[model samples]
Target: MSTLGVNTGWRARAACRDHDPELFFPTAHSGPARAAQAAAAKRVCAGCPVREACLRFALAHLPHGVAGGLDEDERRAVRRRGAVGRPVARPGPRVLARRARAGGCSAAQVAMWLGVSTRTVHRWTAGGAA
Candidate 1:
């Protein structure tokens, strides 16, 4: 099954499929070592047929790895700039309700977790808003 709405069939055509997975997950701090590893992984991505799809998936899911020739920092820049011309995904009302029920949390607590106003959470719970 596809994870995070990504098409896993693309993996078969990815150039990095046979490479070391570590090359895609560099440390947080930037340095020569990280740069080299990321560059190597990017080289593979540059030749992959599904590079665009991989990047889109990474941007949507915020995965921790090099994808579509971009490392974490590059992906963060894309997200911050909204370069993809698509709105970032947000948790829907059903997700909020599930979290509240699973955690036995109140609307305010759910709002805090969702980074939305408590009134928004209340509205969602009442089915007046998403």
Candidate 2:
């Protein structure tokens, strides 16, 4: 059931429901502890059965948290690529390169597959950003 074009049922199944809200919304990037805090938040989201729903909700309503295992940058990347409802994992470089080459594609083309920047594809292909 939805009150305003949003189903509330998913909250019952969210992994962070019982966790501290601050865990998902670390306050500062400059702080040395922020990275570790975000990682801890993400670990909770990593196994969430409702991750997709959470991402969609985050994209629509929540602007500042680790919903669906993604931080602000990742969510921005998803939004910039017009993939509002679909959450996708980064493509493995070897597999993606083979497929890209098979299609006669470029790094930009590969980035399109995962809603990331061309630079991100390069990093992924270079064996980084997993």
Candidate 3:
């Protein structure tokens, strides 16, 4: 794990996973005990930047798994929500083509300047974003 930036490497993002705080609250507990864990989960999630990702992963893999400090049951409640109609849309062909042909360098040159692999550059040129 590179200790250069606060949010650069996979190790930084995976710090929580390494600690495995989810193991502290097992599902074999009673009703009241479960409630206590849920409450604790909310407190932990209050400071987690990756809370959404955690919640989504938990909900999608329900009956087991934890996210945002919450276990499976808690995660499900978060997922039973309606969309806010944020108007999401993907980039079109022309936009990709334009990105592929920046200045006179092309996607290959741009990828090299950026210090990425050639296959990545080819993907950009082929209109397949990284």
The lDDT of each candidate is 0.67, 0.70, 0.47
After superposing candidate 3 on the true structure, give the runs of residues whose Cα lies further than 4 Å from its correct spot. 1-11, 22-24, 78-130
Clashing pairs in 2: none
Error of 1 at 27 (Å): 3.7
lDDT of 2 by residue, 1-130 (tens): 6746899689898889998888898876733245445656777887799988888877777778788878877788888999887646754445544445344456766565445788876665664222
TM-scores vs. true structure, each candidate: 0.58, 0.62, 0.39
Model 3: pairs clashing at backbone N, Cα or C within 3 Å: none
Mark the regions of model 1 whose C-alpha exceeds 4 Å error after superposition.
85-130
1 or 3, which is superior by lDDT? 1
Ranked candidates (lDDT, high to low): 2, 1, 3
lDDT of 3: 0.47
| Best of the candidates, lDDT | 2
The TM-score-based order of candidates, best leading, equals 2, 1, 3
Per-residue lDDT, model 1, residue 38, is: 61
Candidate 3 lDDT over 41-89, as tens digits, reads: 4445545776555444445554554455556654455555532122213
